[model samples]
Target chain A: MNFLESIKVAVNCILQNKMRSILTMLGIIIGIGSVVAIVSVMQGGQQEMNKTLEKFGTNRLIIQLNWNEWDKITSRDYLTEGDIQAVREMGEDIVAVSPLINYGSTAKVGKEKEDLLIYGVSPEHILIENIEMVKGRFINDDDYKSKRAVIVIDEKLADKLFEEEEAVGKQIVITAGSQNNTVTICGIIKAQDSALGSIMEGNRSTVYMPITTVNKMFYDDYLYAMSVKVADSDKIDEVGQKIIDLLHRRHRNENKYIMQNLTQAIEQVNQFTSTFTLIIAVIAGISLFVGGIGIMNIMLVSVTERTREIGIRKSLGANRNDILIQFLIEAVIISLIGGILGMLLGISVAYMISSLAKWPPVFSIGNIILSFAITTMIGIIFGVYPAYKAAKLDPIEALRFE
Target chain B: MIKTKNLTKIYKNGSIEVKALVDVNLHIENGEFVAIMGPSGSGKSTLMNILGCLDRVTSGSYVLDGVDVSTMGDRELARIRNRKIGFVFQSFNLLPRITALHNVELPMIYSGISARKRRKKAELALEKVGLADRMHHKPNELSGGQRQRVAIARALVNNPAIILADEPTGNLDSHSGEEIMAIFQRLNKEGATIVLVTHERDIALHTRRIISFRDGSLVKDEPVTKPVDAVDMMAKLSDMKDKHNI
Candidate 1:
């Protein structure tokens, strides 16, 4: 019989037992449902993470004193002013370098105190961190050279300290250890808006000031970490190695510093997402296998129940292939219908969770197509044996069966 | 046309063997109506199965429409059954789920006929059996006589070389049985060859030729001097029932 005729026969047979057919498709529905929902949600979260990392700057590298060995560290082992000058003059591929000094301090405008991390940096820090300004301008060369007491606070900190009032050009007194310095805000930068920002840094606000002023006021010109920006991200590892080697020689310490590339962090995040997705996929695959077994069980029962009908069709001139194709198509249609329904269910569930969690819903056609391919293969693989059994039945014996 | 020479069938179950048929020789021309009559296990059913291309013989040759089908494989035999032979079972074997029209269309469907053509041919066949108005009703909605008519239409839809009916009226009342016999006789008179198997002597007397079997062997073969007319039989049956009315 022709394929269309087989499909018609299969559909009629399935319709005759609608409740049983739906029950047989349940396993496949749940399997594909969980797979699509989990994968889409995970992909959305991964994409958000990538965006946050991009905001941190993809071509930037951090070279810092090995903090794990802090007990054995000396002041002389710190990244010095001479080292910064040497890196600045190294090559055209080195875009910018700035020593970063993170000092945990509190700022007060009158009696309104806010917890903050004060980063002491040069004008190059803006380029290395890709800091965006909402108002005013970033620290200039004169601000660093003259050791000016100017600060750049993020919009979130500005909102907390000044609330509806202009924060730029205002003064807030910062207390560090036993000393206090009143600094004028020079600029307001955009606040980090990603959910990851709150997760990684908590609720503490951040502000930036000139490295000269910070060094003169607190650590007395000593620094532990430096941020470096490169012209090309692909050459970041090479440049970071060169800088670390230079810092080692300049400080006369072989194991004093380590280079951490931002690109490597991005790759690590992607690897982690892939591993998580793979683990979930394996669980879904197991469920799909169980569903295929369910299909096989139902198909075997159907063949047995319809033995006499098969005999009738064979007597009417249906060959072995015709009977085989009929049963096989029935199985495939059941799974395929399950696959489509599961896809819609999964997408709806993903969107529901995304709306509640405040993340964008991700929809990929490639993954959808792949789910279809997998379900079809499941149908064929599980359907073959039962169809073969039906095809090989003896017509006379089948006819005689009650 | 049907021809068989030393046709034999053996059924084997593990180490046990039963000879269902032995060296049966028979022939009937293209337009003849023949009856095979026997008791249960008398090899008449086995012989009908072989002739219908539903079973393979253990030895000897059986040819239908000049094709030697005894040595044919399953696929080739199925083709022959589709194109050259039609079967009517005692159960009226109309697929219960489909309408009378679709039941009649089944043989054509297996023969790879198109939908439009199959539908037209099925309608014509159903109309020929006087079931044109009940074409849309399922088998369960039909009476025993109408169901048998539907089966006959299904059998005749493909215009096969021969029609084989195995106890076609066994499940029907006398009135329905006469009606089924009348349809068969009408088709036989229209030049369609037919072979019917039955244990009822009265039913066998309607055919032109009778073949009897006993103990896996053909015991008698003879032409009826005067076959019973199904119309006349039905009229007399109705009069007898009416005269004995309570």
Candidate 2:
């Protein structure tokens, strides 16, 4: 028979028993649905993480003190002003280097005392970290040269201290290590919310001031950490390694400080997402395997039920290949129908959950195609035995079957 | 034409072997009406199965229309059965879901005939069996005699050279059985070779010859006189229909 004719017959047969055909397709539907939903959610999470990381400035690198076991005996090792100069001298690709010093202190604004970390850094640090100003100006180079005690307070602190009033040019008392320092607020900085809202929490109640003034008022030895920005994101790793080697030589043959690339952190996050997606996929594959077995069971039952029909066709000049093709077509049809419905249901569920929970759930065409291909293969592989049994049935015995 | 030499069939059940046919030699010419009569379990069905190419002989050479069917593959045998022979079962084995027209068209489908031609041939065959108006009715909706006529139409649709009937009238009433026997007689007179298996001696007497089987062997083959004219009986029924128009 021609292709259309064969398909017509197969469709007619399936339509004759609609309930049985739909029930047989249910296994594949569930399998594909779960796979699509899980994978889309994972893809959405990964995209969200990438967006958050991108908001942190792609070319930025964080330089913190390692202080591991091998460097425990090294005395007084920290990122200094000279190390920042050396990192700038390494290449014209380096954009800016800002040394940061932070101290936990109590700030008093008209008897409302709050414990907060005051971050002291050059005005260039604001530009490098992509920080935005809400009101007034940040500490300029003149403030760092003159060691002026001027600070920038976040919007949250501004709101708490002055209610709706402007807080710029106001003086606040900061007490740390028995030394009470009064600082003029030069600017009101807007809080930065990361793509995933992680950094927003950190910027809620912090303050920023000139690093030179912080050095004079706080501990006089060395700064806490240094943040570096590069001109191009692709050179972040190379420039970070050069800075690390310079810091190691500057620390007198001790590589006590740790250099971390933001790109690397992003990579770690991506790896975590990939691993999580793989685990979910493995579980989904197990369910699909069970679904394939269910198909095989149903197909075997169908073959037994249609023994006389097979015999009649065989007696009517249908070859073994014809019988095999017929049964395989039935199996593939079940899986194809199930797969399509499952994909629809899965995407709908994913969309519902994403909208309800405010989580990004990405619908990926690759995942849809992969699920369909795998289900089709499952149908063929699991359908072979039953089809063979039907094809190999004895014509005489089958015809004699009631 | 059909010929069989030393035709034997032995069925195996685990360790036991049951011989269903034993060295039966038979020849059937074209355009002949022949009947095989025997009691149940007398190997008549087995012989019919072998003749219908539904079963393979254990050791024999059977030739049909110059083809060595004894050694033919399953697919080749199926092809021959579709194109060269038609079968009528005692139960009128029409597919339950299909109407009489589709049932009649089934055999031609396997013969690779076009749908239009198969429909035309099935309609002609149904008309020949006097079921032209009942083509849309399913087998269950037809009477016993009408169902058998539909089965006969199905058997004749492909214009096969041979018609094999295995107890074709076993389930019908005596009047319907006689009507079916008359149709077979008219088909034989029109040069369609037929081999019928029946237990009724009266049915056997209507055929030109009768072959009797017993204990897996042919016991007797004899010619019978007083062969009936099926066309004349159909004409008589038509005359009765005309007279009953009051």
Candidate 3:
């Protein structure tokens, strides 16, 4: 018989016993569903993490000096003017260094006040931090040289304060404990789509000012942390080590500064996400294996149940090949239908899971096609024995079977 | 036409062997309506199985339509069964899941006939058996006579040259049995060779030839001078039943 005829016969048999066919398909449905759903959720979360990491500028290093309680003398371990000057004079791999002194302050627009992280840095800090301005301009070298009382606030935060007025030329009052001042908004910086505007999260957001103004406002001629930018990304590790050595020489404490390559740390997190996705996929694969066994069991039962039908077809001119094709086609069509249903189920469940976890849903057509191809393979692998048993049946005995 | 020379069939269960058919020689011409009558386990059914190409002969050669049966393989035998011989069974073995028309179309489907041609031929076969109006009904929905007619339609749909019917009327009442016999008679008159197996002498009396078997051997093979008319026999049998009731 031709393929179409065999398919027609197989479809007729499935229809004749609809409940059994559907029950058999349930195993495949759950198997493919769980596998694809877990993969999609992991991929979507990984993408969100990637967006967050991109907010950090390329080839940048952060040096924070908080060496636990072993170095408890704040004056000795903490950063100072000498260490700052030493880092800038280190090596050619180092492009620029910006000493940062942050003061947690509150900024008020009329009566609306919100707490914020107010950073004090040189004009080079804007380039090191990769701040993109949406309005006005970042702190220039002239602003730092003259110690201008000017600031650049996050665009989203400024928009919240002044709904109708443009924020670049506006002025806001700032307070830090007993210290108070007013600074003009020199620029409005746009935040990355999936990141918080400030490095630190709070009620307000980020604001940048000249390093001279912050040191004069709150410090006693010392500093805490600094951000260093590398001229070439490939030499970041070498440059970071040089800066650390320079800081250690100035402070006379080798273990005082903690240097972190933000880019490398982000890559490590990405690696962790991929490993996590693989581990879950293997667990899901076990379920699909069990489901394939379930399909084999049901197909064997169907072959036994339809022995007489096989005999009738044989008597009607069906050779062994024809009978084999009929049973084999029946098994494949069952799993194929189940595979399609599972694809729909998996995609929807992934979407629901991503939404609940506060991430965008990721749909992979390649993964979906792979799901289909795997199920088809499973169908053939599981179907062979049952179809062979049916094909090799003795026609006389089958016909005589009640 | 069918010719068997010293055909024997032995059923073996490990070391023990039982002979179902023993050295039987027989010849049947085309367009002949013949019946083999015997008690149960008398080798008539075994002979029918071999003649229908459903079983193998343990010894000797049987030839149907000029093809040697003993030397043919399973695939060739299956082809012969499909193209040359048709079978009708006692239980009216119509597939219960499908309509009468689809049941009739089963044989034609395996023969590689186009779908439209198969449908047309099935309709014609169903109409020939006077089941045209009931073509869409499942076997379970039809009466015993109608179901047997559907079986007969399936047997002839492939246009096989020889029809082997093993107790075709065994499951039916006299009224339905006579109707089945009438269809066989009409088909035989139209030049289709037929071989029927039955236990009832009354059923055997309607055929033109009678072959009687007992204890794995044929006792007699002879033609009837004048066959009994099935219509007349069925009416008389019903009248006899009525007389006994009174």
- Every model's DockQ: 0.74, 0.38, 0.64
Candidate 1 per-residue C-alpha lDDT over A244-314 given as tens digits, one digit per residue, 9 for 90 to 100: 89888887888888888757876887798888888888888898999999999999999999999999999
Residue pairs with colliding backbones in model 2 are: none
Instruction: Put the candidates in lDDT order, highest first.
Output: 1, 3, 2
- By TM-score, the best candidate is 3
Query: How many clashing residue pairs, candidate 2?
Result: 0
Q: lDDT tens string, model 3, A219-265?
A: 54677788888889888887887787777777777677777776676
Q: For residues B139-240, what per-residue lDDT tens digits would candidate 1 score against the true structure?
A: 999999999999999999999999999999999999999999999999999999999999999999999999999989999999999999999999999999
Model 2 local distance difference test score: 0.81
Query: RMSD in angstroms, all models?
Result: 3.9, 6.8, 3.3
Worst 10-residue lDDT window, candidate 2 chain A? A195-204
What TM-score does model 3 score on chain A? 0.87
Best-performing candidate as measured by lDDT: 1
The better candidate by lDDT, 2 or 3, is 3
Model 2 C-alpha lDDT per residue in residues A194-214, reported as the tens digit of each score: 435443334335678888998
Candidate structures ordered by DockQ, highest first: 1, 3, 2
lDDT per residue for candidate 2 within B15-132, as digits (tens), equals 9999888999988999989999999988999999889888899998999877889998878887888887888888887777778998888777667788899889999999999999
